[model samples]
Target: MSARTTLRARWQRLAEPTLVRRSVVSVLLAFVLVWGVLLCYIFMTYKHTITNDPGLQKYGDALLVSLQDVTNPAHAAAAIDSTETWTYIRRRQIGIFPGKTLHALSDADGNPVFASHELKTLNLPPRHPEAVGVITEAIAEGTVYRIYTGHNARWALQVFEPKRTDAAFLAYNGRFILPYLLLAMPFVLVPVWLSVRNGLKPLQQLASRIARRNNDDLQPVGFDAQHRELKPLEQSLDTLLARMRQKVERERAFVQDAAHEIRTPLAVITAQAHVMARSQSEAERTQAQAHLEQAIARTSHLAQQLLDLAALDEAQRPTPRDLDVAQWLRAALAQAAPRAMARQIELSLDAPDSLTTRLDLPALESVVHNLLDNAVRYSLAGGTVAVGLRVDDGGTTLQLAVQDDGPGIPAAEQGKVFERFYRGPGHAASSGSHNDAGHATNGSGLGLAIVRQAALRMGGQVRLGQGLGGRGVGFFVEIPLAARRG
Candidate 1:
């Protein structure tokens, strides 16, 4: 391949994604940019360095000293080699010749009165009269010279030296400086790769530590980072681990609680079934069968409650839309109104027309159903169980208050009501609120728990206070309006 083609191909590989390659290439590129600029500068100043040489400038001055001190212009020719200046120029052996006199001295009339034997052989043009300082000129193949010219009252002084000495000097620097730089390249590039690996040490350690962990270990990494870029990553891992650990603990506790809750009804069922099977008389069998049916019903209720909890735990809520909440609430109330009327309690719903808001319909439906059911079942005959929706915060929030004129719960018990399967004092058999036929309604005590969870999922809170002129309990739910999604 051509040299240019090879270099171009090598240049394109600098962009490869391997870290070691990038690091080594970057270091080499920086060195090349600086070295190229320095090479250009050295060649550009080659002439200046030669003309300004202390030795060359001093030799020229010494040769011209005689012309300046001569008593007459015509007699100045005798000053040639009089100060032994020619011997000084020849002693340096600067050019191709060891003893070449390479300049000519002339008068103001352009007549060469004293000329070096070698200088006359070139047959070159005379120096410009106005050119007063040192300059450079090309003499022949592979030959260049630094020419110095000066004048006094009588004679013009010229001194010349070949530039081979300057080339030799530049080459000297190239030989001593360049090769070591190339040889030391490994020292430079090796350190770059080492630094990249060193910078990534914390990350490698983090991965190994996590990979080696047992499945049950959900603890935070807890490792501090030395680099600023890694700190945020460390914190994020710690946060995720903390959340996972907490979730695991919650799941463990929930399984235990659910098992306990379901076990009681199931045990009752098994015992009642055995009793029904053992009964000999028809009347005794009928009575035992009734008990068995009730036990089965209770177990069924417990299973349904567990299913609801499971759904609430896993269901990803959809983005809320403009819901005619008033309409949905009325539809929800229609289902409860018949149940309330059976107990002679009035079920009433009040809201503005269409009352649009963002809400997950199923979750919100659960909240409505649970709160209203509790209200109707607990209220006294002929008492009012009112469901209401009030828009506030300039339409940014919607408040739902389910107020009933039942015997209100004590302030201390209000907080505990939202707990799973938690039943308050006088909330069961002794309470006036029961299903028709006056038998106490056997509840799983999950109604208000479901209500609280649903409210929280909607970014809201449930507050218990006085209802219906401070005569009974009021459960107030407040939720933020759902943000519009594109």
Candidate 2:
């Protein structure tokens, strides 16, 4: 393949739906979602811990003890100025805490003795001392603070630290967690992709087997499907191949039969032409001309029937409509009237005035025409051919029958009469003089075959039996009302 074509094929394959891709995408999404929720929960828990820091209360208690011994208010204020614990608290204002911290000292009446530089500038009112060791949150100057207060009879002390914001927490921690997730992704995804690919191996093998088959080979695939999910696909493909083989065989047989049947009439036509050219008398020329005409008529009839059979083979399902069957039958008889009159044969229909039913028009027409042709052709001069149409008493099926008062087919040969191009013992093309009806007696033998096939296509069946007066043959076709409606 050219580079462009190869690239296009690769892109199409990637765009196609695959189990491996779906599995990998689903796993990756779930992994990221779970990790995100866990990180959020951890961040919230850490914030809660910092808001209630127990170590801040300890520092407050120590500051209160340092001021307890100084009776003079100036001495009390001076003691906090030089306390190492206070100095350590001052250093942490810019050190351990993410934001600033503040400290305050007050007497029992809430007069401020000392305040950190930032806290003193704010000029905030003294907070009422809570129960010793209690922590509370306060908002001032648009900043939230977690405050710890401690008090004795001599003094009240407070410590404050600003609460950290969510953005600051994520910025500090994401650098560590994101790398771990990226490092873990390949380990999780690679094995999942491999497992999905291995599970689909059987389907790939089945496709490869189909691709390797020759065009003429309609045999079933030999690959044994071990997976339960793949068995139905294998069976369906085999069923389709079997049907294709059957259709091919039928077409081959039809072609061979048509070629064989047409050869005899063609040879006769060629021979008759030669005889007419060589004839010396008017009587001889007339006989040669007559023979040539008969051969041509027979060949024409055979060709028409061949076309009809081929068309029936390829026809789709019929579309049925409501039709007055009795009226239709009478019209068919009128069309066949001249042919019947040629042989002095009488055509009659025995039916009700208006028998309406749903039926496939073309299929019904084919069945009627072929059946009438056979009955009229086979009957002797002055004989009667009867056509009957009626619905059964229950009205579920319509029955059509045609019979002739002539030499009937023997019981032994009746079964073979419907085969294509099948002529009985006395009906051969060379024995045209046996019956008074010249071309009528020498049939192409496709009428009954066409009748049976047309009937079958209409979801009906044909039966062979005794004709009128129990002397000649009869063909009965039965079609179901329910099937016709469909």
Candidate 3:
């Protein structure tokens, strides 16, 4: 690129405007421009008033009187220095510096008669009608002269500043003014820049605080700012941080509980495997291998329940749809048939297939499956697990109940059972399986918790009560009818 283009690009880069630069530059540029205009206005406003000055007027009047005696403008010029008319002016103590003053006379017809010695040397122009003073304008460049005219239309008397002295006078004044204008720039801009920077200091401090935080530090922001705007920002950030902290705590607690629950089964599995590996007799080895298989089955069951609970916590709720509760209960109970048979617990459903409402399919299915599993896991051999669906409250509400002949949750301990990883006093099992191959089962304590979560996700509530004939525990779920139409 050419030098001009290169310089232009560099200047453009430097001038790419930011908030601070625009604010400072706009303020300073406006101040300088306004001050410059003000100075120019005051300098020009009544400047011609200087021509009405008594000291300079006296010179023109005296010179005019001296020229009247000589009618021709040329005799007037010769008489000033060549004749005694010059001596008359010395007697009145009138001072005239020839280098600094000019004299000229012209007839009423506009013909020049006489002029001073320097009049021809000075090329001063005449004043136009719009010019503001008795003197022609003071020149700004080259050689400047103030041309003064005294005229009555019949005769004219003109005096000009002799050696462009106006240039020297203006130059002297400019030297005094220019430096001050240059100095004003920094004074105007520095304060503006500083004020803008200071105004954004709180935001800068907020950014620094955020940047310095540890990755796991989800605690609320703690900076106290003087600015009210930052208060809202701080509050919003703190709210999000508080939520994040809670989520992290929940995750930590969940991991601890899962590890504790899974540890027992894994230990049993490892011990049985070791026994099988070390056994000398064939029958002993076979028994140990059977125990290992049972441990493996229990471990798989525990892991599946853990995953189910985790998924419920993380799953986005599916859109609810109008669904037949009796139909869903039948389907869920059918899925639990194998486990129910393995435990020797009979599963049955009571209600017409027409009993229906709106709820999410997976969530409702999860709730029913957990309830059925709990019933089967805790019930006696050949015990009946009855699932029922009905319409309540003038048919505007749906009611679902799962009751069994299993050992029921006592009334006092019922509320606590829904808590995650909660194992009530009488809730222990002999072994850990729903299959016939394993003797007994100890639940992971997440079944009812999952049921409760699923119920809430479907916008319903669950109640704990006695089973048929008050023989065992029952979980009754109630749902709104409006949710279906909505």
Per-candidate local distance difference test: 0.72, 0.77, 0.69
Model 2 — TM-score against the truth?
A: 0.63
Taking the tens digit of each residue's C-alpha lDDT, what string does model 3 give over 324-408? 6776677777888998898787887888856556667777777878887777876777788888887765767778898876556
RMSD of 3: 13.0
Per-residue lDDT of model 1, residues 155-204, tens digit only? 78776665555556556556546776788788878888899888778888
What candidate 3 gets wrong by more than 4 Å, as runs, is 1-204, 224-236, 319-322, 337-348, 355-358, 381-384, 391-398, 405-407, 430-442, 461-463, 478-486
Candidate 2 residue-wise lDDT, 168-196, digit = tens: 66665655577888888889889889988
Candidate 1, superposed: residue stretches over 4 Å from native: 1-192, 220-235, 281-283, 319-322, 432-441, 483-486
Clashing pairs in 1: none
Q: All candidates: CA RMSD in angstroms? A: 9.5, 7.8, 13.0
Ranking by TM-score: 2, 1, 3
Enumerate clash totals for all models, in the order shown: 0, 0, 7
User: TM-score per candidate, in order?
Assistant: 0.60, 0.63, 0.52
Residue 281 in model 1: shift from native, Å? 4.1
In model 3, the worst 10-residue window by lDDT is: 431-440
- C-alpha RMSD between model 2 and the true structure: 7.8
